[model samples]
Target: MTLSLTELAACFEGVIPSILCTVGADGTPNISYLSHVTRLDDEHVGLSDQFFSKTARNIRENPRAALLVVNPHDGAQYRLDLQYCETVGSGPVFERMAADLRATSAQVGMTDVMRLRGVAIHRVLGLRAVRSPLAAAPPEAWRGSALPRMAAVVDAFADRTELGEIVDAALDALEAAFRHGATMILLHDPARDCFVTLGSRGYGRTGIGADVLPGEGLIGLSGKEGRAIRVSDASRLRRFGAAVEASSEQENRTRSVALPSLPGAMSQIALPMATQGRIRGVLFLESPKRLAFSAEDEAALALIARQLAAAIALSEADAAEAAPDAPIPRRPSEVASPHIRVVHHAHDDSVFIEHDYLIKGVPGRILIHMLEAFLSAGQVDFSNREIRTDRALRLPGLKDNLETRLLLLRRRLEDKNAPIRLLRLSRGRIRLHVAGYPIVISDRKSGAQ
Candidate 1:
């Protein structure tokens, strides 16, 4: 009997690199390695097009292709007879596959070299399980482990009044109940167009306050594309060029260091926290073992992401209501020290403090505005609503995540050991602390139009 595609779902998740066999127009067989085969449905799978020039050429010339996939759980093999149908150069499928491929390439030190040209969709005409003497029994499909208590755990999220409590509870449940090790939650910073690490579990340091640009690393790409990325052997891909491109090496050595990845990570999954067609952040989990997470784990995390997204939205709204209109009393300023020059490059939104890179983009603009406001009016405390309405910030017309941007900016300033600092007074109100450093702002001219 022919096997249903659902029966071989595990093999399609890129647990084991799939082997694709295609015939050239001249009829010579060509084989290529496929890192990602996303299941569109029972009859279709999407393959990421990267380093598949020959495979693409052959498949277009000869529509028939064969794929061999192995189940990571039990080493069982499956063969799929597929027909090359079409290629998607854009949209959700392309973005998802590209993000996965980018993460896969980063693990193997080919980050900058690999680029996803498109996603090739194939029609699976036949699927057959390969009988192997070495095959082992599959792991138990359902573990009454966290599934039973998941409903209660998810419901508890709505009860969380504070964002910190919600984050802590979610991470706590993932570790104590779901058995996830090394997990982190990164909130989105629309102003900066990046994901900033908020909290983490199972790492030596929280890596909190670290910012990752979307489409840079695995976490960044997931957040950027609003997709989930899972890699079985994460350490094997180490190019990390996209991540490094965010900061200058000289700056990392002398000034604030660059953000880091999860320590001792072997396998990892980055899932975007999205709900109501809005992306809030990204959820990342890592482990030191290969194939550490399964489809079930992914499903569970997706549910959690949904719950967290709604909770976060509600919390932010509540915080906005509670925020005060006027700035809090400014703390006594210390004696003014030497002049500190803050340069704002309007071209890229890059900000430099005394030639040391502080932050760029929305956060930089926010800092500039704040410093200007302080210089003009001595304003200290501020609220998310105030920043969101600031005409000078020029925040995107879309739903602005002003709060997360503030968090990212605060963390970055702390990392740089700048004379000015921001303190969170409440969910929405923040108190700014400025040392006696006289601040000077410069608007640098840009070459770009």
Candidate 2:
């Protein structure tokens, strides 16, 4: 029986390297292992062209080539007869392949060594299954249609009006409805050119405020390319949890938060939450079982991610339309407490509450601004409109991401057990609650008692 590319989805996952065989003009055959084989369409596949000079030369001489791929689940093998089509230097396909290559290289600590030159497209002429002597693995049991569960998740997002609640609902749905226990949501910070961990579930630590650069890892690559990337067996890659632990040990000196991760995750997928041609964030999920997420699962997650992105965009729009509320007069504190030292480092806009790093970047700036207002005018209430338009804050224009930044600030304070808290009073309005008097210090030189 003939096998279609869609039926052999497991072989293209890059779990096991695919072998490419080509014949040179002198009739000399050369074989190379491919890092990735992206299925562009039903008739073509794109091979990652990085350090494949011999293969490229062979393709120039002869368009015919053979590829061998294996199904990671059942150890089933297939041979595909291919014809050289074209090499793409730049486009959506190349970018996706490049991002996937970069992520794979980072897994083995060879990110700098492996540089993608282009993606060589090949038309699949014919496909045939190779018989194996070993007994095949049993077929996986069906998990039922995910649409019903996914609909519930989407409905949950609709019910949330606040950015924080929407984020929480998405992560909660991943575990409660989809049975994906380990999940995280990282929002993109355009100013820093990185993604920040805003929400997470099923980790020992929340890792809120952690930063991940574009193309650094799976989560970063997904957001960088604005597409979904999945790994079937991650045991071959370096454990990211160890790196997080190592970074966590130096948290005091670096003031960097650790990224949450599963200790022995075998399968992982990072789905980009994109809307309006801009990537807002990434929804990352991991499981201990190999191939935990099927193609259907990825499609479902991608749909949910899109809905999440749209919901966040709508929430931001709603907040933007809300009129600034009149400031309320400050009331006397119910209890008297000792003063808490609040330090703001001007160099990076990082904030420290009594020597413990609370947050940095835009969120840090926002916190300092609110604290200054509280100290100078005894003002506790502020509006998103004020922060968005505050030239001093210098938030990104058009799509400032004010709501998420505020959420990060609020969560960071709660995580650090600080005396300061940010409470949402209404749409676009928030109140800063300080249990103890705050001693504001700026740039390590100036102080106000």
Candidate 3:
């Protein structure tokens, strides 16, 4: 039976490294391990050009080459006879391979070492499966159409009116429908130039308010490039949590939250939530099993991310269009017995509740504004429109993204289990629920509260 290149899908996932054999003009054969092998089409494949000087030299001298790839699912092997084609330094194929390499290398702290110079395209002349003595194992039960489950997840987004609910639904759907237990949603903060974790699941700590700079890691790189990035096997990479613990501690000293991670995650994918060219956030998932996410999974998740981005944008617009509610008289707190110390650091707009870091940047500024209003006028309710138009807030012009900021602030407060809370009363209105009498302190210098 003739086997098509499509039948070797598992081999292209990079779960197991491939081997390339090439011959020089002198007829000397050279063999090397390949970090990536991308199936451009049924007859074409693209190999990453990194740390392959000898392979490159041989490929130039001899166009004929052989590639051996193994199936990560059942240890099946296939050898492909290839003819070297042109190398691409830039293009869709090159960019895709570069992104994947960057993501994988970043996982292993080899971002500088594993730089992609170009992609060597090759034509598949023939394919031959290696004979094995043992019988092949049956495919896993979960190996089937993901369309139905993907549809259900997309449908789950239909009725979510609030940004918070939408974010939660995305994470929950990933678990319920896709069986991806470890997931997180980090929203982009343009002013701060970073992504902040607003929602997460299946982690020991929520890692809410965690900050990831653009191009920092898999999540950041996906957001920076506005594309999906998947690393099928990260077993050799240093555990992200352990590698960054010291840095996280130092960042925490300056009020930065540590990123959440699964200790032994073997596979990871970061899908960008984007709409109309602007990235809104990132949908990140990781697993303990290698090759947990496939090409189809990435495509499906990309669609879901787009839907989520659009939904978030629509929700924000709807909130912005809401008519201002009639002014309500001040309502005094029923019980203001205990006092909670709220400190606002003017330098970075970081807010802390009784010395516990809560949040910073736009969300922090918004919280301080709300707390100040409550302190002065006993005002429990506020309107989004007023917040957006408030010159003191100095929110970004025209694209304030007030709704998302409020959602972040609300979630952070709840995550911290702080004394203050922001409850959405309607599309444009919210009420501040303070459990204790608040003493607001504003500091101009960078110092401990």
Q: Find the candidate with the highest lDDT and give its number.
A: 2
Number of clashing pairs, model 1? 8
Tens-digit lDDT string for candidate 2 (1-449)? 77899899889988889999999999999999986898888899999886368878899999999999999888899999999988999999998888777777767778888778889899999999998898889778878888887898998878788899999988887788767559998988888889999999988888899888887788877887788988888888974545656343466578788787787888889999999888989989998888889888999999999999999988888988784566544654433468888888887888888888888888999999998888777788788887787898888788788888999999999988889999999898888999888888996466432
Q: For each candidate, what is the lDDT?
A: 0.74, 0.85, 0.84
Please rank every candidate by TM-score, starting with the best. 3, 2, 1
The digit string of per-residue lDDT tens for model 3 on 319-419 reads 89784667645676554869998889888888888877888888899888988888877888888888888899889778777888898889878877787
Worst 10 residues of 2 by lDDT: 327-336
Task: Give lDDT tens digits, candidate 1, residues 107-190.
Answer: 565668878898889999988887887757767566565455566558666688667678778787777665656888888877
Candidate 2, residue 94: Cα displacement in angstroms equals 4.5
Model 3: per-residue Cα lDDT at residue 258? 76
Order of quality (lDDT): 2, 3, 1
C-alpha TM-score for every candidate: 0.69, 0.87, 0.93
Clashing pairs in 1: 106-237, 107-236, 107-237, 107-238, 108-237, 108-238, 109-238, 109-239
